[model samples]
Target: MRIVIVDDDPLVRMGLKAILQSEEGWTVVAEAGDGSAAVAEVRRASPDVVLMDVRMPGMDGLEATRLIVDSGSPAKVLVLTTFEVDEYVFEAMRSGAAGFVLKRVPPPELIEAVRVVATGESLLFPASTRAVIERFSEAGGYELPDLTEREQDVLRELARGHSNQEIAGHLYVSVETVKSHVASILTKLGVRDRTQAVIVAYESGFVRPGDAAEL
Candidate 1:
């Protein structure tokens, strides 16, 4: 996969580049010191994935992600941030970031994150997602989408990180039925994948952090 690293800190960019380069089939196509440079490099180089830092000088990663997606670029952005619980991460996800990996993540995890994101699989794990949800849930309640009874059950299971087979087992429904419900949930939430659907469930108040019902 062709990848670009964007960050104001040279050390961080270099560290990430080195880790990514060590992996087979991954190449560091370009590096940018700031958001504009990152955007320009992405346009010129057309890397498959962009490892973008959230804060930068000329433009923030959020705005850069917005521009990149708005411009119809094929490059999927994976936002990098220091604060794991920051609400802006949620905003970045909503703004079209394919995934997020904490800046301090281990080298192996970083490589994995990039690969998963590049393959278009949204990465929302239980531990990080709970922190993100609680951060927003503290501010105010998020609005839940209008969902049928079955859809609500599916959302609850999804929020708990249950796959289709698991949710089907838990809900005593057919796997096909669970799949249909998940698809309906995604469509009703207006999100691209399961990760984004879970984000909407928490951020929109469809589900609250530590809501035992979800567990």
Candidate 2:
């Protein structure tokens, strides 16, 4: 996977580059000190993923993410933040970030997050992300689509953070079947990914925050 690291801290950028370069089939194509530089680097490198820091001296990651996404760049953004539940992280997601990981995340998990986002899947950081979604979704009040009973079952599993493979196993179906359900779910709900779908499920009262365990 090709990646660009964007952080104001030199040491942080270097450390991340070292970690990513150690892995096979991964390359650090570029590095930028701040968000503006990040935009330029992304445009020039055309990387598959960007590890973007939230706070910076100028043009913070949230704005940078908006510009990148609005510009229709294919690269997915994975925001890096020091705080676990900052409002800026939520803003980053709204700005079209694929997901976020805490700065203190373990190296293995960080690498895994990059791989997940690179593959066009949304990364949900369970505790932190779910909390953010719940708080914001409650305010926005999502509207549910006309999903069939089986689709609702699939959505409930999705809201619980189950993967396509895991959902298939739980529903006694194939992965491709789960993918089909997921696509239909996205289309019906008029959302982008599973993360947004889950948010809608929660906001629309299709799936309660506590329903995951009961389902």
* CA lDDT of each prediction against the hidden true structure: 0.79, 0.83
Model 1 misplacement above 4 A: 120-122, 137-150, 162-183, 212-214
In model 1, the Cα lDDT at residue 126 comes to 53
TM-score of each: 0.79, 0.88
> Which stretches of model 2 miss by more than 4 angstroms?
213-215
What clash pairs does model 1 have?
Answer: 142-204, 142-205, 143-204
lDDT of 2 by residue, 1-215 (tens): 89999999999999999999989999999999988999999999999999999899989999999898887898899999988777888778777887788889889989888888787554455666766665665534566778888899899887767778888899999989888989999899876667767777777777665666534
- Model 2 steric clash pairs: none
Please report, as a residue range, the 10-residue window in candidate 2 with the lowest summed lDDT.
133-142
- Models, CA RMSD each: 3.2, 2.2
